[model samples]
Target: MSRIQCPRCQRPQSHCLCPLIPCLDSRTRVLLLQHPSEVNHALNTARLAALGLNNAELIVGEVFEDLPRLLNQPGYRARLLFPADDAQPIQTYGASDEPLLLVVPDGTWRKARKILHLNPLLAALPRVTLADGGVSRYRLRKAPGPGALSTVEAIVQALQVLEAPVSFEPLLRPFEALIEGQIAAMGEETFRRNHAGK
Candidate 1:
């Protein structure tokens, strides 16, 4: 049997394309507040998103404990990148904004609820949700709806929204290569079998 691990989480190198992690160069900083449970999961997109951004920080813990300090970090105009629900619209940052995009990746619905229940600090920061509808690239995890987006995609969208000229295409390219590596390591049948049920 081939011994490979998921590229993203590096868990025994399963059929995970996470190793195809992308690196991005942008002015806007990204801070990923990941749930501790997702740290090693093959399908966790927050980890992948962190790899893509140059100014990104991945903190694994409960949101309440982990996010406040990062927000208090020097020189970051922090904003929570959640969905643009009717109840909350995108709060605008200044033209000369020192932007920080805080991404919560425990899946969309769970993340939304997490912020609602645990993150009082997050509420105080500017909130910006995506209005342009799209689907998530994280096939291993199910989204809350059709418009739900993956962490990487969400970052790309956020960058675009800020008019930052960061190249997201390069970030996506590695994902396919990683997927191919995963398939090669696991054999197509086994890989498909394992992922199909999820």
Candidate 2:
């Protein structure tokens, strides 16, 4: 019989401790425009971040068709959260500042590029990149570059850039546990395979 999967981690639900996921108190609003393919991914970090933050909105779709009108309705500022290369610098948020828009395009390198190209509205937003000198915890997926950070990690760094408090730190702690749990599950699967061969 196949091993039971963890409902939270989707690994072997027995090993999933996603319930331990931390919540964050943030003033800056986070808008996650994720691809539909990424919504159900077990390794997707955007979902984790959304779960942690109170002002986070995760929209899984092909385009930002009605997004602009929605933003116009209430307190919302639009900004694209991509790499800050030669494009533009990350903006700073003030105490009475408008909502900081964080558009995280979730997918593989090719898929992400497609998401950007296909969505003109998102492409038109002010692009801001993260400048963290740390490695990514998204071991399951290969990054396009050294600066390629996961959605959650990118948000944390962005929050720091905006001078938000350490309230977001707690949101990242479970990520380490999530990675460790995944690695352990993989090891267990490998051990079982080897034993069966023997």
Which candidate has the highest lDDT of all?
Answer: 2
Residue 77 CA displacement from its true place in model 2, Å: 2.1
lDDT by candidate, in order shown: 0.62, 0.70
Q: Candidate 2: list runs displaced more than 4 Å.
A: 1-12, 84-86, 188-198
User: How close is every model to the real structure, measured as TM-score?
Assistant: 0.71, 0.79
Cα RMSD (angstroms) for every candidate in the order listed: 4.5, 5.1
Which pairs, if any, clash in model 2?
5-12, 5-13, 6-12, 6-13, 84-129
Q: In terms of TM-score, which candidate is strongest? A: 2
Sequence-dependent TM-score of model 1: 0.71
Give the per-residue lDDT of model 2 (tens digit) for 1-198: 988876544545665656767766676778777888886676667777887787787778776688666455366667777754555666567667876656677766667778878877767777877765657766655666676777788888888777544546767866767766666767966645543223
